[model samples]
Target: MKTKIGLFLVVALFLNSCSTSKTVGKVPLYEVLVVNNDGGANIKFYEILTEANEIMLLLGDETLKKKVKKEDAQKSSFIILNAGPTKETFNRATVQKVLEKEDAIEVYIKDMQKNVEADLANENVFYPYSIIKINSKKQIVIK
Candidate 1:
């Protein structure tokens, strides 16, 4: 009886320790660039970069375009959403929610026209995209 009880206790502890941890919340939007226009956002592609070489290849700017602070170890996990030129305003692309699932990281976004009033007098084509920093480095699946 004593051995059986001890065995059960050990098994229970092991199971508890193996529980999965997830990050679920409204993640902040990492806005680095600002483009002035009244337009819409049509996501062309989403890229996940954790290495310096890859970051430079895609997010490189000044030397001549998209860039991420690649030196910091803490900001290793980055998901960038790139949008194509839009005729209407995709004014505000927001990251609504982030779910860290077992297989992948799920991201919910709002890429529609913003309700807030904007000066349309100087209306021009706008390009918009959203980016977020995730706790995990899992593959992102946008929803």
Candidate 2:
């Protein structure tokens, strides 16, 4: 009986070792690019993550995607400045603090419409892409 028990334990261990479990990762449902509409910044795309009527933008690459919690992304707006493209890839990001939506939009519109060489002093203009979140009424309100 002891030998049989040992054999059963060995079989169980083998089965456990051979067993595989699938890991489900958060997949990006929507992708939007914040482009300059001018000839300046390197454009990059973000994956929009939504939950509980709130939204967050996740930065992703070819293989892996990072998850953004709704609370952490609760800001007036996000800004993505051109980080400059490397020989291997083009990376744009919102590494800085979130700015006011109006401020970001003003900068973006100015950069897009203006071609004044003198205004190039303030050329590092960033754009804003407002994420409208669904409210309790099921109506989309700009966040």
Candidate 3:
């Protein structure tokens, strides 16, 4: 009886450890490059927030891409974002072209709170048996 009890306890402990060791889909704090394609000469960087709201700086472009070699891109600043599945690479000329575009580009992680806020704000409300439209509009309009 004593030996059997000891074996059971050992098995329970092992199972507990295994369960705790499993990897959950949690966001990690890491940096990513945000190449702005806008015509603005100045380069702007922002930190990405993980699912847990952890922020990390951008570490510049240092990945393997077919066209853009590692040496071609310049390291500016750091920003935080969730680590993506595939690595992204960019060349100096491509970065320049991206910077030259009309829209400003940023690479950072978004938190769950922001996602919730956006979802709550973007919904449409309807009244029962009536044409009542609940239009949730923003106060400020940027041109």
**Native-referenced Cα lDDT, model 2:** 0.33
| Top-lDDT candidate index | 1
Candidate no. 3 TM-score: 0.22
Candidate 3 residue lDDT tens string, 15-45: 9888846568743222223332222111222
Write model 1 residue lDDT over 23-74, tens digit each, in one string: 6986343333333343234435566766656655544545214334544324
Q: Judging by TM-score, tell me the better candidate of 1 and 3.
A: 1
Clashes of each: 10, 0, 11
TM-score, ranked from best to worst: 1, 2, 3
Model 2, position 54, has a per-residue lDDT of 34
lDDT of each: 0.56, 0.33, 0.25
Q: List the residue pairs that clash in candidate 2.
A: none
lDDT (tens digit, per residue) of candidate 2 on 1-143: 99999999999999998999898985322222343333333343332333433333333322113323344344322323333322222223322221233222222211222222223245444322222111122211122
- TM-scores, all candidates, are 0.47, 0.28, 0.22
Model 2: per-residue Cα lDDT at residue 3 = 100
* Residue runs of model 1 more than 4 Å from their true location after superposition: 1-43, 56-75, 87-90, 113-123
